[model samples]
Target: MAAETKQSCYEGSSVSSFQFYLERSGEHEAILRCVRDVLPREFKRTGADKSSLDVLGVGSGGGQVDVQMLTMLQSTNPGVPITADIVEGSSELSDNFRALVEKTPNLEKIPFAWNIMHSGDYEKAVQAKGNMKKFDFIHMIQMIYYVDDLADTIKFYHSLLKSNGRLMIIVEGEKGGWDTLWKTYQKELCVDAITQYRSSGEVIACAKSLGLKYEELPVPNQFDITDCFDPSSQTGERLLNFMTAKDNFYESLTPEIRSGILDLLRHKCSTEKDGRVMFDSKLSCILIHA
Candidate 1:
C-alpha cells in the first residue's frame, strides 16, 4: 500500500479518518478485483465495434480502488475508452483520487474523467456534474449505509445505467465475519449492539424491485497482528496505528465499561499464549443490472 499526504485523505478529522485507509490498500485490492470481475457481467454486447461503456464509481473513497479498476481496464485493452465518472462526496478523498490518477502511469493515460459529488446531494450533484441515461457500470462500495434513502438512491443510479449495465453494491454482510468479531468482543467490549446496514437481503430485494438482474459475491477478511503484540515489535505497525486511532470507539461506552473493555482487549491482544490480535471481517458484493 502506498501512502498519501495527510490532508488529502478523508472528509473530516475523525479518529477513523481516511489516512488509516491509505496504508491498507493492499488488503482492499482484492475487493477491487472481485468488483471488477463481477461488474462487467451486467453489460450485454449490443454490437461489435461500438458499445457505450460508461462507469460511475459511486462513493469512491481514497480513489485507490478507482485507480486499480482503471489500470485493470487499460491492461486488458489499451485503446479502450471508458467514460468513467468518479462520484464521491468527500472532497478530500476526491482530491486524493485526482492526484493519484494523475501521478499513476497507465492510470493517468487512460481516457476518463472524474466528476466528484458529495454523497448527500445526489440529484443536483449529478445534474451539475454528470450525464443521464445508462451507465455501463455503477459501483457503490461500503457506502449505501451512509445513504438516508437507499431505495431512492438505487432508483436514481438505475436511471443513470443503460440497459444491461450493472449497478454494483458491495457491503459488509451482517452475518459475515465482522459480526463474528463483534460477537466475540461484544460482551468484552461492553457493546450491546453494533452499527451496520440491516442485511444484504434488503439490497437484493431493492434491486429486484427495480427490475435488475442480481448476483451476490461473498468475500471474507481477517486481521492477524501477532508481531505487533511483542510491544517492541514493529512488523504490523500500520495495523497497530489503526487500532490506536480507534481508541475513541470506547467513547460509546460508559467510563467503567470502557475501562473493562480496554483491559479485555489488551489481554486478548497480549496474552502469553495468544499474542496475536485477530478480527474476522467479511463483505458481500451485490450486482444489479437492468
Candidate 2:
C-alpha cells in the first residue's frame, strides 16, 4: 500500500492504498462478482412485494465502492427502488463522497442520505429515537476492528436487519502477512490505543459463538512494496507506518527491530519478482442472513 502521512492507515489517511489494492488485486471485481452472484437470491428472499430496498453502508469511505455496490443492486433488481443511508465519521470524506455522487450519471437517481457521524454515535442517536429502521441490506467493510465489542456490534446490526436482510462484512484474511508478523511483534508494532488484530477468522469465530451462520469468499490481494525498500523515500516510510498501524514507526524503530520487521516482511510475508516486492494483503468477505 502507498501512503500519505497519517497516524494510522485506517484513520482516513491515504486513498492511494485503497486505489492501489483495487487496481493490483482486483478485489473490487471479486467483491462485485460475489455481490452479483448472491444478490439474486437475497433479493428473492427479501420478497417480490417490496417497493424499495433500504441499504445501510457503515464507514463507507469516499463512496467509490459503495456507489458501485449500489449500482450493482439497482441493476440486479431493475425496477425495485433503493434508498441508501451512509454513515461515515469524516465530514471531509462525506463531502467528497457527496460531490462524487453529484457527478455520477445515473447514481443521482437513487435516494441518498449521509449521516456524518461515527458508527457508534449513529447507533446511539438511532437507539435514542426509539424507532429503529430495519434495513434490507447492510454492509460494514474493513471497519469492524474499530468497534469495542465485535460480537455485540454484529448482534446489534443483526437486530436492525429485516427478517431476510443480508449483512456483508469484509475484513483482513488470516492467511498471512501481518497475521504472521504480528504473532511475534504485535506488542511492539501495534501500539495504537485500539490495537485489535481481529481478522476474518476472528469474525467467523465470533459469528459461530453467537450462533449465526454465514458464507464467505476469499479476496486475494497484493501490493507493490518496492518503494518500501527505499529508505530515502518519504512515501516508503509513511507506508511502513501504515503497515504497522503506528506513528513515526521509522523514527521509533531500533536498528534491531527495524531489521527484524523488514526481514519478516520480505521473507515471511512478501514476495520479490523483477526487482519489486509484492505484499499479499489477502481479505475475506462474509454474508449472513438475518
Candidate 3:
C-alpha cells in the first residue's frame, strides 16, 4: 500500500490541471445540459406556500456551473426571493466563485452565503436532523467522491430538503475512465483520506439502502486523451496528473509503477478512435426526491 501523503489539486496550485481535465473530458456540455434539463422542472415543483427558495451548492468549484444553475432557477421563479448557500473547501475556488457571481447578471440580486469549508466539516456543524425542510434545492456535483461517508452525506442532505425539495448529485459512472482507473490503482493513487472511488452505481446502492426515492440520469461523455501518451505534451501531463490526483506524476513515481499506470490508462480506460484515444468520461446524475 502506498502511504506517502500527497497534496490534492484541491489544496495545491493545480487548478489548471482540474480545468484541463474538465475541458478534455467535455464536462461542461453534459453538465450544462443537465442543468437545463432538470432545474426548470425542479423550480416548478417549488411549493407555492413558500415565500422564498433556498439553494445549497456543495463542492461548488469556481461557481461557473453553479451560477448557470442558479440563473436557471431565478429565471423559472422570478420575483421570488432565492437564497444560495455555496459550500466549497478551497479558498481559491471560493474566491473564483465570488468573482464569478459579481459579473453574472441577476445573480447579485440573490443573497449568497459562502461557506469555505469541506463538506465533512460542514456536516459536522449541521445541527438539523431529518425533515428539516431547510433547502428547496441541493446539489453536489463532481464532489461526492471526496466525502468521508457518502451514505451519511446523502442522508444528511436529504434530511435538509423540504417536502418538495430535490437533491441532485453528479458523479462518475461505472462506465468511465475514473472508475476503471480507481478500481485498478485506488490504493496507490489515493493520496488523501478523503479520496474515494465510489461511482454512481454505489450511489444508487446507497440510496436504495437508505430507501430514498431517486431517479438516475446517465450523461454520455468522453475525453480526448490522445495527448496523454505524449510525454512532452503539457496538456497531456496535466490530464495525467489530474487523473492520478498527483502533481508531477511522471517524475514522482517509480518507473515500473509509472509504466504500469500508463499502460492501464491507455488500454483499459480508453479506446483508439480515428487517430485519437477517446476516454470514457460518462457521468451519472442522481436526483433524490425529498
Local accuracy of candidate 2 as per-residue lDDT tens digits, 62-134: 7777877777777768788788999887665677789988887678878888887777777889889999998
Q: How many residue pairs clash in each candidate?
A: 6, 0, 0
Query: What's the CA error at residue 96 for candidate 3, in Å?
Result: 0.8
Off by over 4 Å in 1: 1-9, 21-26, 36-52, 109-114, 127-133, 177-199, 209-211, 225-247, 256-275
Candidate 3 lDDT by residue in tens digits, 1-290: 11111123254555655666666777878888877887787787774667899999988888878999888888887788999998887777778889999999988899998877788777776754432338999998888877778789899899889888899998888757878888788778765643667888899999999999999998788878887889999888888887787768888788888898888878988888898988888888899999
Overall local distance difference test of candidate 1? 0.57
Candidate number with the higher lDDT (1 or 2): 2
- Of the candidates numbered 2 and 3, which has the greater TM-score value? 3
* lDDT winner: 3
Better of 1 and 3 by lDDT: 3
lDDT of 1 at 52: 38
Every model's TM-score: 0.70, 0.87, 0.92
Model 2 lowest lDDT segment of ten: 1-10
Residue 255 of model 3, lDDT score? 84
- Measured with C-alpha atoms, the lDDT of residue 21 in candidate 2 is 43
**Pairs in clash, predicted candidate 2:** none
